[model samples]
Structures are given as C-alpha cells and as structure tokens.
Target chain A: PDEGAMAQARELQGRLTKPAGSLGRLEELSIRLAGLARTCPPPPVDPAAVAVFAGDHGVHAQGVTPWPREVTAQMVHNFVTGGAVVNAFARQVGASVTVVDVGVAVELPPSPHLLDRKVREGTRDMTVETAMTRDEAIRAIEVGIEVADRLLDAGAHTLITGDMGIANTTPSAALIAAFTGADPGVVTGLGTGIDSETHHRKVEVIRAALALHRPSPQDPIGVLACVGGLEHAAITGFILRAAARRHPVILDGVIACSAALVAAAIAPESVTAMVAGHLSVEPGAAAALAHLDLSPLLDLGLRLGEGTGAVLALPIVASAVRALHEVATFDTAGVTDA
Target chain B: PDEGAMAQARELQGRLTKPAGSLGRLEELSIRLAGLARTCPPPPVDPAAVAVFAGDHGVHAQGVTPWPREVTAQMVHNFVTGGAVVNAFARQVGASVTVVDVGVAVELPPSPHLLDRKVREGTRDMTVETAMTRDEAIRAIEVGIEVADRLLDAGAHTLITGDMGIANTTPSAALIAAFTGADPGVVTGLGTGIDSETHHRKVEVIRAALALHRPSPQDPIGVLACVGGLEHAAITGFILRAAARRHPVILDGVIACSAALVAAAIAPESVTAMVAGHLSVEPGAAAALAHLDLSPLLDLGLRLGEGTGAVLALPIVASAVRALHEVATFDTAGVTDA
Candidate 1:
C-alpha cells in the first residue's frame, strides 16, 4: 500500500463537490482503497471471486454442535448445485463461486466449481491431539494460496472469503481465544442455533484445548495447527496472498474473522488489504474484528457464513471507489463550496 | 399489508436449507416484504425510481449556513446533467432519476428529467412569517403524491426519496422538533458544514419558529405550513401515496426523515411501508427515525441527501427477498437439521 496515494486521495476528497467528510465512512474506505491501488482513484472492485473452503471438523464428535458431521459434505453439494444461501447471494452480486474441498471426509466427485485440495479427510479432535500436524496445516494453507492465485489469474478484481464445515465454529472460538487472549465464554456463541447446555459444553471444550496445547499468539502457524479448522488455515493463506498482491479481500463471518486474525498475526500489514464485510451475530466475530480494528460495512445481524455477508457488501465497496472516480470536483463542476 | 403472507414467509424461512434464524434481520425484512406485496416471496424491488424533490427555503436569510441559495438551482442542473452524487448512485443501481421542482426560487426551463411542478418561488421566511399558507402546503403534498403515482404507474417497484433545498435543514429541524416534541437544540445540527456559532444560530431560529407557531403534532398539515419546507411537504405526500399502494419507500437523510415524521403523523399506518435507508450524520435523523421506530439498513454516516443512502441500500433490500425466492429448503436439499 502506498501512503502517498492515500494522501492524494484525502486531498481529492476534500476538493470533491460534496462537503468535506459528508460521505463519512465511504470517504475513508475510498482513501484506503486508493492506497491499495497506489493511485488517487482506484479502479472499481468488481468481478469478485468467492472461494468457499469446505472441510469437516473432528470436534463434532465431542458434541459441540447438534449438526451431524455429514452435513459438511451435504453443504458442499448444495453450494455446487447453486441451492445454498451463499450461491444465491453470490449470484446477486455477480461474483463467481468456487468450492475448495480442503478437508471434507467424503470423497467428493469432480465437479465444475469444486477444487480437490484435500490435505486430509478431516481434522483430528483437538481435545485429544492437535487439529492437524504442522506439515498438514501448512499444506492446507498452500491450497488456499493456490486457489487465490488461480482466481486472481482468472481476472478477479477482489477476493471474498467463504467456508462450510460442520461444527467449525468450535475451532474458530478456540482460535480467537488463543490470539486475542479473550475468555472462551466471550468468544463463543450459538453456532447454527445451540441449546444452553450445548453452548456451555462447547466453551468447556475450547478451554480444555487451550489448557492442553497452550498455543502462543506470536507463533501464528503453531496456533493455527493446534486448534484451527482446515478452512480457517486456508482462508488465512488466501488473505495473506491477497494482501501481498495489494488487492482487497472481503471477510465473511466468524470463520473468516478468525482466519483474518491468524493472517494479521503472521503479517501485520495484511490488515490493510482486509475489509470486514459485516458484523455477524456470533460473539467471536465482533471480538475478532475489534482486535483487528476494522469496522464492518454492514450490521444486519447475519449469522450465516459461506461468504453471504461478503457478497452483500460488494456494492458498498465498489461504490466507495466509484465515488472517487466518478464524482466531479467543485472546480470541475463550477459549483461553489461552503 | 397481508398478515397471512407474512406468516407464510416466516414458515418458509424456518424451512430454508440454512439454520433457522441464521439470516437474522434479513429474514425479518423478507417477511415484511411478503406482507407488503401480499405474497409469500415478494417480487424483486428492481427498476426502482428516485424522485429528488427540489425546492428552496426563504429561511436562507438567517445566516444559518454558508452555502449560497443558488446552489439549490445549480444542483438541479447538475442532477439533470447526470453529474451529481445521486446521479452516480442511481446509475450504479440501475434506478431512474427524476427531478421534481416543487418550489425552486428560480424559474427554470424544462429538461428531459425535470418535472415542472413549482408550488412557489420558495416558502416565506419562517422567522418573519409562516413558511407557506396551509393551502400551499397542501398543494405541495399533493405534488408529492402525484409524482409517486406517475413513477409507480411507469413500472417502478420501489420509490426512493431525495431532496435538494438550500437552508432546508433549518425547517427540517423545526419539523422534527415539533413532531417529536424534542428540544430544538437536540434536533438542530450542522447542515453541510457550519461553524459552531452558526449552528447555535440555527438552533435558535428553529426555537423561535416553534415559539411563534406553536405547531401541533396532531394537525400534520398545520405543522408543515408553519415550519416545513415545500420539499418536506412533497416528500410527506410521496410517502403517504406509496404506503397506500403497499409499495416500499426508502427514506434518505435528515430531510427525508423529517418529512417521514410528518407522513407518519398524518397516517400512522404509513410507517409500515417506510424503510430507513441509512443513519445520517445529522442529529435530527436519528431522533426522527427513533420516533418513527424504524431501524436503518445502513449506518455509514452519510449526510449528503439526494437519495445516495437509499440507493446504496437498495441491493440489501432486494437480496432479502431474493433469499426467500432462491434458497433451497432443507427437505428439498435433503439436508438434516440439528
């Protein structure tokens, strides 16, 4: 990101026909985008690609969620058949959807939008052992980086994070607690609707994992390998790759936010390329976003993941840059300023 | 609105492939749209129409703002020439922009998108006398209703409110203060950037007008004639007519919010069709929206009216209904629920 371009964007915003700061957050978003593009007016954020990383969580065996582990494979089919909520939202925003099978237990047959990048069938139960070995974690991350490279090479102007994994929120809560040092209760919430008893058991499961592994925030990869889901590792890699390329990436709900924390810990500068798409209902999503110091673009109480929130915020991100490029300055339009 | 359709929409939302209530506010919004359209899954709110009601305020004599009154007429030209912010946003959402000159001070020639319906050159200075006679206020309200009818007849599924009137914020603050029974100081704010001293003076002006007219909230027309701008009255009519036809009307910034107060006052049921597009930086907008009991879809700090906030929110509103129509049910997708 270019600081000089940001300075130029701020100067340009002041000279636009509208009052200074009247556009509020949109003006700041545009300025940050200018820095990302290294230009006074960044190009439109369009033709976005949504990479939905599907995996299965071994924590489901511990009864953290009521949903069966097979639901993960079922959702992958739903996403491919364009019957999922994420598919509908992606269509609304004209963003291409690609499902990456990073760690689903089922052997998914080849499909048009499916990417077979299975590092393993499913993660190990963190209550008993690490979610994955260090090498397997790194391999899953590479899959994410490779998928991001493929999408960027295909001319996607932006990247949107999506994920589908049964009981994935259990790992997400553990990841957030490890990174932010927040209490397990503070970061854990009802995922896909859970009873009070289930929620309490989920929190204790996270606390037990943290007590056993003692993951350190300084070593992001170690922390990820200890408790993070396969999709979480992949999304972290996707965000890191996008940030390195100076392109913006829109993050979805709790799953994506937890991955973003990992990405930010690994490369502090990656936060510059990240956009918090929406404030999810999951309590951890807010804590992760607050720790990252990113304001979400929308707050519609959305709890569903799978990149739905990111796709919904695409127009707002595009409009911010479009205002910079399209609006006439006071001098250009010959309009008097206050 | 059909309660039966709303109930059916709720039933369908629970059966969506996603977990029940996972979509959060979007599910509620879809249900409301179903009631408004009298169908389980409402049609898309597309090919929308934005009617920017342009007027002038004689209250510019008060030195409440630094912007020249001529900016109002000049902005009308900017809108017609497709150089304004509203024009850029409307083009982004594929919505048509129509300028209705209900009360501009200047006599403008007709243009392709301009509707010549000037009720007067401008309202009288409220500090010296009533802004307009009761008859003129009624006529302006009638102008709003007629424009809404025309746009709805031309195949517009949704109506977005926009306004351009120099010094209109003074009257808007007064209208809000009168309708909400709030202190003038609490409702008045910097309109398009004003110094602290000017802001104080604006509050005093509103207080003085309220003191003089003693407008009653029950007599909605009297309140408009006493302390409201012509565009405010017209927007009130626009909201009323839209509600009568059971179509959604998205409200913009403080100007639109103040007018909404008047419309809701006249017919309490009109609140059913109103959608708060975004929370403006203006203090009165929040106060007015609170009085109307409507939650805004976006809170991006937009203060420049002209329907930019409403236009930005159109996609979110459309997607809410799209979810109901496109998302597969759990039984249909053959996915097990928790």
Candidate 2:
C-alpha cells in the first residue's frame, strides 16, 4: 500500500506544470506524500512546528567548548524568551518552537513553549560511564515521538528538527564514528571553535568514549545509551515519528545530522522524508551526510547550530514544492520542447 | 548623505537581539536598512517588487542554448500566464513580478504585470555592431529607474532585480571579463546547458564581441552600449534607483551580478543596499561576486536564471531583517556573554 502511494506521488509530481525533473527533491517530497497520504496533491502543508531538543553533555567536563555548561541552560532561557537566533528564525517562519529539556542539569521553569521531557538531569559522563541507560534512551525517543504526534495533531504539515546542547558535539562525533565506521580522529572536529591543540583533545575525548562504549550499529538503542546525548536520542525518535506519520522533516547542521543517522539506522525508509538543510563545516557532518546519501541544499560554511540553517532553507523547499505544484508543463504553456 | 543613512542602518542592526556577530549577513542587512531608510529599524519592508527585465540578444541567432529564440517570448508568456517557476515562487512569497520588455524582437500583448519599456526590438549582434546605442542604453536605464520609482510609490521597501534575455550570457561574460579583469576562458562558462562544442562556440562568440566592442569599465555607459544587453542596462538603472531611494535590492545570478558590477562602477555606494542571493555556477558569477566583494547567501550550483535564485532567497532576507527587528538582546533575555 505504501509503495502504491509512493508511485502515485511520483506520477503526480511528474504531471506538475514544470519541466520533467526540474523541481528536484521537491518532486521526491510530492511522491513521498502520495505514499503517506494515499492521495494525489497531498493537502497543503501548513502550521509547521519546530522541535528544538536541548541537552548538555558530560564531555563539557573535559572542556570541549570554551563556553560553560551553564550557558546551555541560559541559552535555553534565551530560546524560551525569544532571544536566540533560532527563536527569531522560527518566529519569522511562523513556526512555533518547543524547546525540549531532555537532559539539562538545570531545571527549566514551566512555560508553554518549553517541554519538560527530561529523562535525566544530565547524561552520565561518557568519559567514565555510559552517557545514558537503555531505558533512558527509550524514554528520550518516546519523548520525541510524543512531541511529533502533538505537532501533527496540532496541524503541522512539516516538522523541523533542531537541537541545542553545549559540548554535545562530543557525543555526536562518537555516534558518527560508530555508524559510519570512521575513526574518531577522522570524524571529530573542533566544536565551538577550539584551537588545534584543543581540537586534538576533543578528538581524543571522542575516541575515549568510543573505546569505552564499543557501540554496535545493529543495536541502535544500545548505541544511544552508550554514546548518544539525550537530544540525539530524542531527535532520532522525532525523526521516526515524523516518518511514520509521513511528515517531511528538515535536519539542521552536524548534531541533528548525527541524530538523523541514528534514526535512519532504526528505520531506513525514514531517510526518504529527510532534507539536509546545509552541509556543516564539521567533518562529522560531512561523514554523516555521505553515509546517508543525502545532499544538502545549501553550503555557506555555516556552523551555527540552532535551526537557523533549516529556517533559511525553508523558503527554498517551499519554492521547490511550489514549482512542482504550480509551473505549467510544456503542453500547457504551448512551449516547444528543447 | 547616503553614508549617514548607511551608518544608521548599521547601528540599528547592531542593537538587535542575539550576539552582535551571530546573524552574519543578516546583521549586514539590518545595517543596510538604516542606510536605505536613513533611519534606525527601517520601516517594515512591504510591497516588495521584483522587476524582471526581458530582452533578446542578436547572438541568439548563433545558436547558444538548446532552446530557440522563440522560447524567450514563450517563457515570457509563461511568466505572464503565471506558469513559470518565478511566478510560483513570487506568488508564494507574496511579491509582485513586473515583466519589463526591454528588448524582445516580437511585440508583446498588453498585460497588467507586463511593463513595455523596449529600447529596441533587440540588440545588434555584439560580434558585429555594438549591442545597443549609448542613447538606447540610457533610455533603457531610465525605464528601470522609473519602474523603481513607481514601485516605491506603491509602497515597496524592497526591490528585487531579475532579468530574462536569450543568449544573454554572451554579453554577461564579456562585461564580467572587462570589469573584473578575468581571462575570457576562466570567466566564460557553458550557459543554459550548452554542450562542450557549443560552449566553446559561445566563448568564441564572447571573445569576438569583446574584440569588436573593446569596452572599458571607466565609461560605464559606453560599456553598456558596447556589449551590455538591454536587460543588463535596465537592471543597472533599477539598482541605482533602489539605492537612491534607500530600498534594498536583491540580485539574482550571473547576468544580474554582471549588471550590478556596472551599476557599482557608476555609483559605488549603490552596493550598500544590494544582497547577492546565490552564486550562479556560471563561471562569470564568482568573478563578479569577488569584484563586488559580495558573498552569496546560498550556493546550490543553481544556474537557472530568471530571478529564480533571488526569489528563492527573499525569505532569508526577510528572516534576517525580521531577526534584526524582533530578536531580544542579551540583556533582555539575561543570557550569559559568549
């Protein structure tokens, strides 16, 4: 039944007014819609929701970023207060942002936009112990799935997955290394602008975590428990829920891309609904993108996390979909074939 | 006087919430607003207008693109009929598109969105005669300026400059080479998907045009007359008018960028209000961007012209300006210093 929908979606995109194959991934999106909705010209996408998963990493104790872990909680405050770059972008795009406190050590005050989905105060120090337990990982994933369901029920046709975590790149790097089978030294990069010496140290931190975890890709939940941050696990679950619901999800930057790799491992078909917003300058981001066989729509050497990349990319996606839905074909325009 | 406005614009952007340097080009845009409006927090950008200058090149007879000359009129019809990609994007973004017939060999029917401002039916073949007369070039430019004034009076705070001309790359390459001092071989590229052999032929076509015109950048008007297409001259005028009116202008791809280079030569301060949407994979585009000291906000290897890149980028610009106007300051959010 899903295959039939996918086929019908592809046919509908082919019949859109533009030249064959002109709308690019948007054509893929329209086709994906057919499979998901079991209808042609899937109902207009409206009321998009953005889930920004916030967490902190034990690797902060290892001094990966110059910024303190407390800044993570403060930025979460900024997000709730609409002061962060992502808040501005989300507001401009007319998407409501729900910041998930999956694993911040500091407690967040209750607010409409803040979702207290914390599985733990913070992940266990991966340098010494597993970052999370299997149960915690599952709970985080469930949190993500629940958020996706709520957004879907609230009439969000698109769900943009974003993450906010200080020193989170350490876990993300560890996850990328395990999934892509890349060495830690090859996949890890300077997070938040570490010097060459610090960058090397960051890599060692990732390598140490990898050695301690020895995560197997076949055991996705085990992998998250071993090395993934709470935000990573949550994003993975969110992606799955979005896929299962047939809603398109835009992945932002390296951390989100790493989480997406985990989601894909959980459900390969989920990869179909994903659109990479931009290729981050981070080596791990490139590795993750290559592993997923997904090409980013923009490359501006942007390393700023938050959902800024995804928000910047939203208009382009809308353009592609609009092209697929609106441009007249050669026959309709009475233009001769090339 | 313009310098004062620009300084004000910069100050306004600097005051917007989020880190001072976080939003990058968006911060630059907020500053651009001060300069354009000559006031802080430039009034909300509304009634945006995209003027698409359409022309025809005598060089089209030389067989450049797989597309024939008639396709220019046919596509213009598509634009008028709202069947073009730009139409869909503009509609989705809530901007008006004005199709200006600067130089098309065929007569166009009157339409609400169509602006008939032909300098001539078409340009003289640059490989033989100068493409346009100096007087005709001025007239076309005047047409662009008048369009800008009309749009501004109609309450547009932003102007998007687009162009549509067949075999326009011939003139664009020549102009880029003359202005940027780039080698013809390096700056010339296969436009509109011409095969290698035809690509080489197009290069020869540009070289012959350059040899015949021997254009100089010092005399910007003379350069426009020598090899600039009608649409190119018109865009130059449009950009200047936007700057003079303190309105932000979004530049499309290679052809528009090439015209911007000429406009910059005429009035260097004009560049203060211009934002490059994307770098066209067109060889001349990078050189043009470098000469203008402008970095493109997006690069997806898009070579499709017709203001499509600019229209796609509009939302990002809007987001940036909105960020300047909306995002809270560190003090307001009580977030820690970076």
Candidate 3:
C-alpha cells in the first residue's frame, strides 16, 4: 500500500461537498482503497473474481456436523453448474465464479471453471493425527497463489473468497483459537446449525486437537498443516498473494476468517489489503475479525460460507471507491462549506 | 402487507439449498418484500426511482448550522446536474434521480428531471410561529403522493426518499422528539459538522420550538404544519402512497426518517411497506427509526441525506429478493440437507 496515495485521498475527501467525517467508515474505506490502488480516487472494483475452494474435512467422521462429506463434491458440481448460492450472488454482482478442488475425498469430473488442484485426498482426522503434511499444506497454498495470479491476470480488480467443505468449521475454529489464543469453546460455533449435543462434541474435538498439536501461531504454515483444512491453507495463500500484489481481497465467513488468520501470521503486512466482508453468525468469524482489527461491512448473521456474504458486499466496496471518484468537491459545486 | 405471501416466502426459504436460517436477515428481508409484493418471490426492485425533495428551513435563521440556507437551492442544482453524493450512488445502483423543488426560497429555473412542486417558499420559523398553515402542510403531502404516483406509473418498482434542505436536522430533531417523546438534547445532533456552540444552539432551538408548539403526535398533519419542513411533509405523503399501493419505499436519513414518523402515525399499517435504508449519524434518524421499529440495512455513518445511504443499499435489497428467486433448492441441487 502507498502512504502517499492514502494521504492524497484523505485530503481529497475533506474537499468533497459533504461534511468532514460525515461519510464515516466509507471515507476511511475509500482512503484505504486509494492506498491499495496507489492513486487517489482508486479505480472501480469491478470484474471481481470469486474462487470457491472445495475440499472434504476428515473431522466429518467425528459427527461435527450432520452434512455428509460426499456433499462437498455435490456442492462442487452445484457451483460449477451455477446452482449454488455463490453462483446466484456472483451473477447478481457480475463477478465470475471458479471452483478450486484443493482436496476432495472423491474423484471429481473435470469441467469448465473448475480447477483441479487437489493436494491429497482429504485432511486426516485431526483428533487422531495431523490434518496434513507440512509439504501438502504448502502445495495447497501454492495452488491458491496460482489461482490469484490467474484471476488478476484475467482482469479482476478485486478477489473474493468462497468455500464449500463440509465440517470445515471444525478446522476453522481450531485455527482461530490457535492464532488468536482464544479458548476453543469461545471460538467454536454451531456450524450449519448443529444440535446442542453435536455442538458440544464439536468444541470438545477442537479443544482436543489444539491440546494435541499445540501448533504455534508464529509458524503459520505449521499451524495450518497440523489443524487447518486444505481450503483454509489455499485461502491463506490467496490472501497473501492479493496483498503482495496490492489488490483487495474480501473475506467471506468463519472459514475465510480463519484462513486470514494464517495469511496475516505469515505476512503481517498483508493485513492492509484485506477486507472483512461480513460478520458471520459463526462466533469464530467475529473472533478472527476482531483479532485482525478489521470491521466487517455487513452483519446479516450469515453462516453459509460460499462467498455469498463477500459477493453481497461487493457493491458497498465499489460504492466507497465510486464516491471518491465521482462526488464533486465543495469548490467545484460552489456550495458553502461548513 | 400480504400475510399469505409472507408465509409462502418463509416456506420457500426453508427449501433453499443453504441451511435454514443461515442467510439470516436476508431471508427475513426477502419474506418481508414478498409480503409487500404480494407474491412468493417479489418482483425485482430494478429501475428504482429516487425523489430528492429540496426545501429551505425557517429554522436556519436560528443559527443552528454553519451552512447558508441558500445552499439548499444550490444543492438542488448540484443534484439535477448529477454532481451530488446521491447522484454518484444512484448511478452506481442504476437508480434514477429526480429533484423536486418543494420549498426552495429562491425562484428556481426550469430543468430536465426537476419537478416544480413548490408548496410554499419554505416554512415559517417554528420557534416564533407554526411552520406552515395546516392546509399548506396537507398540500405538501399531496405533492408527495402525486410524485409517488408519477414515479410508480413510469415503471419504478422501488421508491427511494431523498432531501436537500439546509438546517433540516433542526426540524427533524423536533419531529422525532414530538412523536417519540424523546428529549431535545437526546435527538438533536450537529448537522453538516456544526461546532460545539452551534450544536448546543441547535438543541436549544429544537427545545424552544417543541415547547412553543407542543405538537400532538395523534394529529400528524398538525404536527408537520407546526414543526416540519416541506420535504418532511412531502416524504410523509410519498411513504403513505407507496404503502397504500403496496410498494416498498426506502427511507434515507434524518429528514426522511422524521417524515416516516409522521407517515406511520397517520397510517400505522403503512409501516409494513417501509424499509429503513441506513442508520444516519444524525441522532434523530435513529430515534425515528426505532419508533418506527424498522432496522436500517446499512450503517456507514452517512449523513449526506441526498438519498445517498438509501441508494447504496439498493443492491442489498435487490440481492435479498434475488436470493429467493435464483438460489437452487436443496432438493433441486441434490445436496444433503441439514
């Protein structure tokens, strides 16, 4: 991010016809976007790209959620055919959707807009063994970086995260607790609206896994490999690459929030280019966002994690930038200043 | 609102691919919109129309704000020329803007997209006398209803409220206090970034006006005539007409919210057809919204009040409806349901 551009944006906002600081968070958002674009009144955040990373979580075997693991592949097909929630929202915002198969348990048939970048079958049951090998986590992350490059090269000004992995919230809770040093019970939530009994079991599973691995937040990749899902690792790399390239990435729900914890841990400076799209009903999403010092744009109690929240917020992010680009200055409008 | 359509929408939402209650407020918003549209899935809120009613405030003579009263007429020109914040946001959401000269002090020139619907040359200073005669207030509201009819007849599926009036927040605070039984100090705020002295003076002005008029909330028209701007009276009529016709109307900042208070008082059932677009930084806006029991969709600290906040929220409103219309059902997508 360019400090010079941010300073210029702040100066520009003061000159806008509206009162100083009346736009509130939107004025700050525009300044941040200006810094990211390296110019005052940053370019429009159009032609946004959504990468829905699909995987299977071995924790499903532990009954963390009622949804079956095979549903992961089913959702991948749903996303590819444009029948999923993410697809509907993407269409609404004119953003293209791509499905990244980081690690699905079953073999997936190839299709357009589906990138087959499976690292392995699926992460191991974390309560019994490590989620994945360190090398496998790195490979999955590389897949995300490559996807970010592809999306940016194809003319996407903004990158949005989406995920479809049943029982993935188990790993997300574990990762958030690990990075933020919060209690497992505090970070875990009822993923997909689980019963109270299953929710307790889910929290217990996360606590046990964290106790077993004791993954240090200082080593983000090690923490990811030990307890994080392939999609989480991939999203971490996606965030890192977006920040490295000075483009904005809108994070979706708890899944993306946990992944952002890993991305921030690996590259602290990358946090500048990240935007919390919405506060999910999942408690871990809020915990991660609070830890990152980012305030979400929307709070609709959304817990579905297919980038639906991020896509819904695309218009808001664009509007913030558009304000800087299009609003007339007080002098130009010949209006009396307050 | 049609309870049958609302019930049908709730049932339809349960069948969506995502888990029940996962989309959260959006699910409820869609159901509410369905009831307003009287259908399972409401018609898209496209070709939305924004009516920016411009007026001058007699309260400006009370020295409530630093901005000159003439800025209201100047802003009317800025809105017509598409240089205001509301115009920028309207363009982003594909909503049309129409400036209505309901009570500008100066004789305005003819222009395209500008409606010459002046009821009077602004209102009388409420601290000294009634803001207007009761008959004049009723005429202003009639103007609002006529504008609503013209916009709806021209194919606008959604109506957005906008206002351009200097020192309008002084009257807004009085209206909110009169209707909600709130303290003047609690409802009054610094409009357009007034200094501490001006803010204190503004609150005193509201308190003095409320004391002088002692307006009755039961008689909404009389209250408007005593302590409301022409834009406020007109917006009340606009909201009433939209509710009478079973169409949704998005209310903007403090002025619109104050008008909504009068509208809801006149026709309590009209609350069913209203949507609070954004929570304005203006204290009166939130007080009025709370009294109306409408939760704002966006809260970006926007106090621009040219329907900017409402225009920015158009996407969220549209997306809520689109989710119900487009998202695949669990059975259709062949995914395991929770």
CA deviation > 4 Å runs, candidate 2:
A1-45, A194-201, B1-47
> What does candidate 3's lDDT look like per residue over B65-153, in tens digits?
88888889888888988888888888878899989999998899899779999999989999999998999999999999999999999
Better of 2 and 3 by DockQ: 3
> For model 1, what is the error of residue A169's alpha carbon versus the real structure, in angstroms, after optimal superposition?
0.8
**Deviation in angstroms for B236 in model 1?**
1.1
Q: Where does candidate 3 stray beyond 4 Å?
A: none
- Candidate 1 residues B96-146, lDDT tens each? 999999999999878978999999999999988999999999999999999
DockQ for all models = 0.78, 0.45, 0.79
Query: Model 3, A1-338: lDDT tens per residue?
Result: 78999999999999988878888888999999999879988889887999999888888889999888888998999999998888888887789999999999999998976999999988999999899999999999999999999999999999999998999999999999999999999999998999999999999999999889999998999999999999999999999999998899999999999999999999988899998899999999999999999999988878999999999899889888888889888899988786
Among incorrect, acceptable, medium and high, the docking class of model 3 is medium
- C-alpha lDDT (0 to 100) for residue A167 of candidate 2: 86
User: How high is the TM-score of chain A in each model?
Assistant: 0.99, 0.92, 0.98
Query: Model 3: which residue pairs collide?
Result: none
Q: Report fnat, model 1.
A: 0.75
Interface RMSD of 3: 1.1
What is the alpha-carbon lDDT for the whole of candidate 3? 0.91
Residue B251 in model 3: lDDT: 92
Best by lDDT: 1
Chain B TM, per prediction: 0.98, 0.93, 0.98
